[model samples]
Target chain A: MRVLGIDPGLTRCGLGVVDGALGRRLSFVTAGAVRTSSDWELSERLLGIERGVQSWLDEYCPDAVAVERVFAQHNVSTVMGTAQASAVAITCAARGGLPVASYTPSEVKAAVTGSGRAEKQQVQAMVARLLALEAAPKPADAADAAALAMCHIWRGGAQDRIARAQQEFHRKAGTARRARGV
Target chain B: MRVLGIDPGLTRCGLGVVDGALGRRLSFVTAGAVRTSSDWELSERLLGIERGVQSWLDEYCPDAVAVERVFAQHNVSTVMGTAQASAVAITCAARGGLPVASYTPSEVKAAVTGSGRAEKQQVQAMVARLLALEAAPKPADAADAAALAMCHIWRGGAQDRIARAQQEFHRKAGTARRARGV
Candidate 1:
């Protein structure tokens, strides 16, 4: 599956697209941040991001979008900004009808580095190793986005299996009930 | 000056823009929400919000953007989402280079109503009366945003005066030092 991972921000949104199947090598399609002009108003900046995301979607045409789950911090002002950034990401994904999955920082780190408590540098190193890139992704946010996509791919297959089993069980139960005509 | 107040959210961002000077009249702006689809990834949703805010900024071009400062909540997930929303607004403001101000919910309510402990409806009513709006702004988020902007205007003006006084004091001290030549 082709996955688009995102690190949401108000001024800059880091995006990484990875394409692969389960237990296979994943390829990076594109990754970068969309930055808004300082002179533009909030609305304009938002629109800039919108257009940027649209272009990315058009280019990648990915099957799913992965985003980092929000994490709370001590700074009130910072928290407010992070919330808005998340809204922007959610709206964009919905508009495209792309299935969106969220990965917590800990989960992403664990998937990439095999440890939830892995430091930033460790996570970056692991991402570099997994992707076999010459160096780690620039701007930690981008690396985090890539890691989220990787985590989703690894865990998504298991989730799909569980969902399928549940569906089959429910279908069989319904069939049994219909047969009894009770 | 025209000031725009923002109540940033993951699903919705309530905005209210008003004339800041003179009688503090309510302008043509009102509160509106931008919603993202649940299916989309969080990153896509955040990018959508960035576009929305950018649109708001471009449309209004408010002299300043005022946002409500949020504290940590009991729910880790909810609080984290709120923080991301806040980040969207702050980053957008910074990108626009507009003076961004923030106020606590209590401060906003106190400014709109006489008491900080006022209920949502109470604060809305006072905001309508204080700004001379024909009716209260629809949705509590909108009212809160307007209240936040109003608080900033009041508080910002006071802060400016205080800053001027401090500058004057410093200037006097410098003059005295030069006269003494010590």
Candidate 2:
């Protein structure tokens, strides 16, 4: 499955797409940052982000979108902007009828580096290693976004598989009951 | 000028339109809440808000939009939703090229009730009095939305006039200087 991960911020929104399925080799598709001007008004900046996310979705066309869930407790000043940006990204994906998922920063770090308290550099290095890239994705935002996508593939993908398996099992059981006229 | 006010929330986004200008008799255009189902997904709820705000803008055709500025410092549990909803509303207005303004909750309360620390009922009471309505706008969110529009008409409206005046003064001064051949 192809997943697009978003590390949302007003000043710089990270967009990354990774292609993989559960227990499959992951490959990098694309990674970039949509940077908005600091001097622009709040609405204009948000509009820029909205358009940027739209363009990213148009170009990459990922199966699902994963965003980093924002918390109000941390980063008192930037949390609002981050929340706003994430809203734009998630809303855009949803408008396109794609499933949207969000993982906390710790959840992403733990998934990527096996440590919720992993350092940024450690996560970056692991991302590079996981994707078999010569270098970590440039700019921390893009790397974080890539990590989010990977996390979703590992966690959400497993859930998807389990759900499909349950449906198949139920279908088989129903067929067996019909054959026995029960 | 006609102004649309939004008290943005994920579950129930308030939308209100008020007609008036600086120092003019403010009248209510319309007020309502865009209620979304809690059972809906986050992105689905946001999409519902987007469509609701768009329909309001389409029908009301307001000259500008006023939204309550969300702060991360307050309502930790609900602030994220508020911020996301505000972003959706502000972005919708911006996309339509309508001027968007935000006022803090205190600003709205103070502008409507003469005190920033005024109670909700007090603000609601003053909103009814200011609009000359027989009753306050039903649903606290809608009432708050109206108050936001009133606040913009009082404060942002003045700033807008000053800006227009400055531009007019500049134009006249330029003409005078040209005519004087200085």
Candidate 3:
């Protein structure tokens, strides 16, 4: 399945699309960053991000969307802005009626470089090699988006299936216990 | 001028609208909350918020929209979700082509109760008195939203004017410096 990955930020948001599935070779479709001027008002900046993500969704038509999950940071304002941008991405995907998934930073690194603690350069290098690119995508953020897309393609579907299976097993167990009149 | 204030949250988003200008007695137009089910997916919850805020904007056509600025919280996920919700409110205002403002919690309290550290009940009671309401709006969140609206009505215009003046001053100063070749 094709997947679109977004590294959400207020000033610079990265968008990448990859076509692949589990146990299959992945190919890069497109990747780039959407930037907004800091001089603009917060509302305008958010609108710009919304429009950018919507355009990518319309152009790529990926089967699923993956977003970088916001985590706690020392700077409250930065974290807040990232979370806001991430939310816009999620909302846009839902508006398009596409499934959405989120992966943590370490998860993306691990999936791409086989090390959760991998450095940025290592992840970028591996992403380039996996996609057979002439060079790593520029601005690092775009490469990070590529890694996120690959991570989702490699692991997201399997994880969802496992979660669903676990839910089903629990439901059957509960029903069986009810039949025994615990 | 009419002002609409939003208290952004995942489950319970508060909305309040007031009509008046600086130095005029403000009157309550409406106050309520937009709620989303916890059982819903994150995307669905966000879409519900977007639709709810959009409807309010369409109905009220407020001169300005005010959102409660999100702050750091002990719970990372909760704070992230709140920031996301606030972004949706801002995006809606921008989409409607309305100017948007944000007020911190302390600023709202101080504007309503004359104390930055005022208690929730104090702010609520003062909001009721300011707007001549029969009683404080219910769900506390709604009352807080009312306070935010009043705060914007009282302070936002002056702040915008000051910002514009500063910008003009800098522009003139830069031109004079260029003339002086310094």
Q: Who wins the TM-score comparison? A: 2
Give a tens-digit lDDT track for model 2, residues A31-142: 9899999899999999999999999999988999999999888888999999999998888999899999999999999999999999999999999999999988878899
- Stretches off by above 4 angstroms in model 3 are A74-77, A160-182, B73-77, B159-182
* 1 against 3, candidate with superior TM-score: 3
Error of 2 at A161 (Å): 0.6
- Cα error of candidate 1 at position B89, Å: 8.0
TM-score for candidate 1 (chain B): 0.86
* Candidate number with greatest lDDT: 2
Show model 2 residue runs off by greater than 4 Å.
Answer: B180-182
Candidate 3 C-alpha error for residue A86, in Å:
0.6
TM-score of chain B only, all predictions? 0.86, 0.96, 0.87
- After the best TM-score superposition of candidate 3, give how far the Cα of residue B108 lies from its true spot, in angstroms: 1.2
lDDT of 1 at A106: 87
Candidate DockQ scores, in order: 0.25, 0.86, 0.57
TM-score of each prediction: 0.63, 0.96, 0.87
